[model samples]
Target: MKEGNVISERFLLNNERALRLFNGYAKDLPIIDYHNHLPPQEIAENKQFVNLTEIWLKGDHYKWRGMRTLGVDENLITGTASDKEKFMAWAEVVPSTIRNPLFHWTHMELKNPFGVNSFLNKDSAMSVYKHCNELLSQDEFSTQGLLNHYKVKMVGTTDDPCDDLKWHQQLLDSSFTAKVKPSFRPDKALMIEKTQQFKQYVQALSEVSGIQIKDIESLVAALKSRVEFFAAHGCSISDHGLAALPYSYVLTDAEKREFESFLKTDGSVYSNPDAFAGYILTELSKLYHEKGWVQQFHLGAIRNNNLGMFAKLGADAGYDSIGDYKHAERMSAFFGNLSLTDQLTKTIIYNLNPADNEVFAAMTGNFADGRMKGKMQFGSGWWFLDQKDGIEKQLNTLSNLGMVSNFVGMLTDSRSFLSYSRHEYFRRILCNLFGTEMENGQLPDDEEWMGKIISDICYYNAEAYFNLK
Candidate 1:
């Protein structure tokens, strides 16, 4: 393989059939990134990055964490360092990230958009930076241009209920080809443990929804109003990030009263955090079902572990890690309750901890709706589990427990425009997995038939699942 072709044309494809499936079925398929953290405003404005660091290093906690691991100075990582200096610091850590996904991601990103086939390292940092910076200065390197270059058909950006979605509206009127929509993410609304923060969030929610949130009923009403508002703005999906699925079907009336009391006071402690979260999430899920929206739960992440670094850098600063939690019961209770009521809409569950793979996969089977093709989806490998082994494990598990043919495929779940290479990464892995099966005769030695399945998992399934025609 060439220097920058580290993830070559046949990087993960091991056989001739694998290569054929990748090139013929998956390579040029349009991307519909159904969930991600990319900023809608950047796409609306078509913002041009000034340098390599600004585009690649900024807000990328994956690189920041790697830099910190190398004992790189805080100043160079996220402090008041020059952009070039930060790029150099990142390049210094690139070679050290040999077995890490960042290593593959870095070179693939360079090779695709910027056409830099040289490997990135401290020795080659200056030339790579200068070359990439020149490319960044081009109009084709702007935000919208990058999305277009990657053949992105649609992107669903994570957004708060309090947002006006003005950027999404702006994109609607613009000539941008790809559809940019919002996914309602009201995680903070469920955080009653953070009293002041919750209060402030509720107040903002009230202001936006034009409804006073004095109690649980009013709070739900306000959230419902926002849901309707979001629906008007072309949002048909809701996302939640939680350490575990919170569920409590037997909370005492006194506990509910305590929640009401806590809401009215600036109390130092809220003892009913679990019940409150469960109650609010249930109500929200009902609203999601009513709206015919897909509800996504991203579970098992213990976030902001290092308080000192958290205080210094804040949330999503690379301090989060996989968490262990008993998920089966709560997941069953939550979905089973909705299922019983005939209120379970299309749903996708993403597990951060790979240990819960079987649990999540089996649980999706328990609530499968016969009406919808892939209603209960065990989503693609996410966060800490989006790499080769993770992807293969998820696919194998889903295939064992359910129909792999109906599986909705890869999502960037990323915060960068250049991360579209991840889709390429995922496609190559998918083709390799199926094609290798064909080679071994475990599956039929058929290209066209298997190619359809590969293309479906890569693109067609998601298009149908999300109703993104």
Candidate 2:
């Protein structure tokens, strides 16, 4: 294959039939970025990027982590380095990320939107930089324009309970045809460990909800008000990022009051933080179900490992890692409670620890009640697992444990405008997975039937599962 065609026509697929299905059906299907970190304000304002580095490297901890591994200076990586200098530094590091997924992603991104077929590196850096920068300067290369160019049908951006979602409202009214919506993310509200931050967050919630949060019940009421506020704006999803699913039994009011009294005398420590988190999560799920929303749990993340770097750069700056958290029992208890109460909304569970793949896959089946097509989803490969091998493994595991046809697949889960092509990358992998099965006689070599399955996995399943009409 030619260097320019790094992601060639038959890139990941093993056969022509699968390749045809991908290119014809799945490739052009509109993207539903059901979960992501893309700023809604950028889309609302239709902001134009000054240059490639500002857009590509900014707030992208994935690339930042790789550059840091190469000993790239903080100045170039995230500090006060000039745009050209940072681009040059990134170009130098590009060739070094050969076997890494960043290598493929970088080249593919360069091909699309930028329309640059030439490779990206120190040698071609200046030319590629100048060329892409010129393109980005145009009105068609603005933030909304980039999203539009990728044919994004809808995007569900992660949002905090405290956010007003004014940008989402603006995008709804803007000339942009694509739907921009918010996904309620209440991670901080449930995190009661940080007394100071939690107090401040509660105060903010009180101001928003006009509820005096003197106790756990009042806090839940404040959160419920925010949920109502979010629902009014057409939010249909709630996302949680938790290290582990908390399952400790919540204390009764008497027990909680006694602990609160004891804490006053002890000067530190309160009632069980685990019970607090579990109670809040359960209450939130009930609200989610009542609102007819999908609840997503992103589990097993060990965040902010390096305190020094976390202090310097703050959270989500490549300081997190995959965590080994016991999930099965707590997950069962939590989700089971929802089901028993008939408050189990459509759910998606994403496990960061790949070791728990089978556990999660099988668990999804345990909750599969014949009520909905895919009421419980083992979510697509996410964040750290959004690459070739990871993608394949997830597909295989889901296929083995559940109906792969019912699987909703491939979210950008990214913070970059240019990351939409991840959907294409995933489509190629999906086709390859099915194609390999066909070639091995595990699945029938029925082109049209196979094509429909791949198409659904790539686009329609998510559309239907999320009710994104």
Candidate 3:
């Protein structure tokens, strides 16, 4: 019925300097999506989507959360609804997402690559659906093609310690342009709280590593072996998802024997689970340092709040929320353990709670050895905080408390191929922030210096941080 492009060329940048920096430098930089849930299979096989909804709506918890907020039915949001019906349901919700970053992100995704700049409302649903579906059928819209179009230089997919990385291996062997590598995520290995899952996971680990995990000692050996295996396949990153950093409480010899006994058998957990977690994490961090891997820790998520939904749909299906965890002391202790031993590697810490922005930022400064360019990074806003207000707050806080110029920039953390436009969304906001400060005379009017700063934050910093050529 009507047509418009909400995310214009100068949409986010409020000042002339911001606009010039974004256009001249940040826009064309190669994307190093250092952390995401993008399926390696999709990239290796170059999977083609049958329709727009398959790529846009299918399995995107971000959109699901929005639609469910407005009382959209489960069937329409994630159930067995027709593709057109789900697109229309999302169309109904898109216009209502005003002031939400999703509104800008959705429109930007539509505008770029797909060439559909009109607002995605109920009226334009059919037209936009047809246009996007047509493009999805082409070779250019397949997984690899989308990576090529976006200039994605490297992608680090979150992976378990036991993962065979068959898809990653396939990509490495193929003539594919993108460097698809795996980042070791050993969250489950550290999850000693879940008895059943932990036991079954140990079995899987034994199967993969051929090392029968009889106790905590064996578990460490198995994980170390996997780290070597991953490094062989070009893994330069490792990630941990913890509620907060675990501390090392001193243990007596008797208690230590008890803990080891429990580890080999199904009994009450170690008396000092926190200390155990800290010890294992420290050991792993040492290995990471030895291998020169960048270690990432995502903290402060109080997940599965909605028990009914959690039981029905499981985790990361939009049931997680921010937690108010007191992380500074334990975080410091954890880092202190590594740094004191001279075993601290390049580390990025992502806090989900915006309230803890300054806390996390300040923590990064505590361990800056000047050895690594940005030795300790306050990571980009993630999960619950991956929005405009949150992104700006994190950036501003990092600038105030640490070196924002050395920041590694944004990531999708998304399960969708259409989410690369988020990089554009972030770069614009970044330039706007820098340019606004210049306009207010808070910073010197230096476009060349400012442009270089913006460009490095967007691309060069990430390339150097991740050691990507």
Candidate 4:
């Protein structure tokens, strides 16, 4: 087999300025990964993988989706197949993922920590697997070691409201270098339509907070207690996953009473699930404002479409897709209400659909109070859009509609430690964009000014935005 690097040092650095900016400014900057699904227990325990599959393939829905696309069998993909078998199956599909970002990401990850530069395919599977597995056994490849290897200063793991956060506390107590802060993810709290899940969540929240959640008032009180509990644990960020921002008025006394009755006995879902969510979210945002936390909304995901597969594998198992939802009016109303009462806090909004890029970016400008730099953020391209085209469109849209300079940049939003390679991917693309513009004489050719802006978007802005410094 021919042997060579899959990606060179200048892979995405399209111009001299792009190369200069990436190497000098963006490459070595410490990462502030403010949002991800990294398991706190794995980080706290310093778990080491037995093989490449354990760390790389396990829980990686992106790869799983790609494998499924080429008609890979269920057993090899996610079933009772041996670890080696699944890794081999994924290797078989890598070459076929030519235009996909997974193709770039797979090669980038292989090159970075494992140093296996040759392209991964059926022919090279065993060799690549053995090489990476050998490296995974090292201390530097351990979970904490990987974070340190990438110079991750802080990681905000998505956590539920009812989460005990014992693992987070363990990280805080340990001699671990990176700050593993929890970001309060109360998505299930807004999912009242999932009757069984909602009830269980309320029970769990009550158990942890010692608050009896009998109605909307009690539920709000319970949520508030959890918010304070999370803040005590060094968490100053909150996240929500929604289809779209739902516009609704604050519940009246009569409506609150009606919701209380509905909570006592499940009946017809209390008029509108969205309205209940909006009311609760409004109340929660007020608490977020009071606590000075940054709130994030990842909107427009239509999840669990494949019910048969959903039953077999569950959510986040490569079954979700981008949702088409109108945003402008509802968002304006939602933020408008928060602004009216001075209850608005620093917020980041992520859109899954590329069509909503301009809408999401413009919405951020509507609520910027001038009290803080980039107080309202158009978040990084996320979920289905976490790739080259998505990132470019998001950046271009933000530049056209708002200030891209103050943008708090990229995040992993991934379950794998190897996903840190995405930061390099984003930085190279970012530098390329700016470099191309400079080469065209669209912007002034001052290295210092452009370099500082690059560094800020890559690291410093997020540092100040999340108060991580």
Model 3, 1-469: lDDT tens digits are 2446576778988879889888998999999999999999999999999999999988898889999998899999878899889999999889899988779889999988888778889988899999889999999999999999999999999999989999999988999978998999998887767767877888899899999887667878999999999998889999999999886734467766775677567656656667767777888999999999999999999999999998889888888888999999988888987877798999999999888999999999989886667899999999878877888999999999998889999998888998999899899899899889999999779999888899999999989988887
Clash list (residue pairs), candidate 1: none
Q: Report the number of the highest-lDDT candidate.
A: 4
Task: Report the error of model 4 at residue 404, Å.
Answer: 0.8
RMSD, one per candidate, in order? 1.6, 2.0, 1.5, 1.3
How big is the positional error of residue 107 in model 2, measured in Å on the Cα after superposition? 0.4
Better of 1 and 3 by lDDT: 1
lDDT (0-100) at residue 341 of candidate 1? 85
Q: Per-candidate TM vs. native?
A: 0.97, 0.96, 0.97, 0.98
Off by over 4 Å in 1: 1-5, 250-252
Better of 3 and 4 by lDDT: 4
Point out the higher-scoring one by TM-score: 2 or 4.
4
The CA lDDT of each predicted structure is 0.89, 0.87, 0.88, 0.91
lDDT per residue as tens, model 1, 376-416 = 99999998999888999999999999999999899999998
Candidate 3 residue runs with Cα over 4 Å from true position: 1-3, 249-252, 263-268
Q: Could you tell me the C-alpha RMSD of candidate 3 in Å?
A: 1.5
Model 3 poorest 10 in a row by lDDT:
247-256
Give per-residue CA lDDT, model 4, range 1-469, as digits (tens). Answer: 2448678888988889889989999999999999999999999999999999999988998998899998999899889999999999999889899999999999999888887788899999999888888888999999999999999999999999988999999988999989999999998888888887788788898899999888888899999999999999999999998898877857778878877777678544667777889999999999999999999999899998999999999999999998888888888999899999999999999999999998899999988887889999999999778899999999999999999999999999999999999999999999999988999999778878999999999999999999877
Clashes found in each candidate (C-alpha, N, C closer than 3 A):
0, 0, 0, 0
Q: What ranking emerges by lDDT with the best candidate at the front?
A: 4, 1, 3, 2
Higher lDDT: candidate 1 or 4?
A: 4
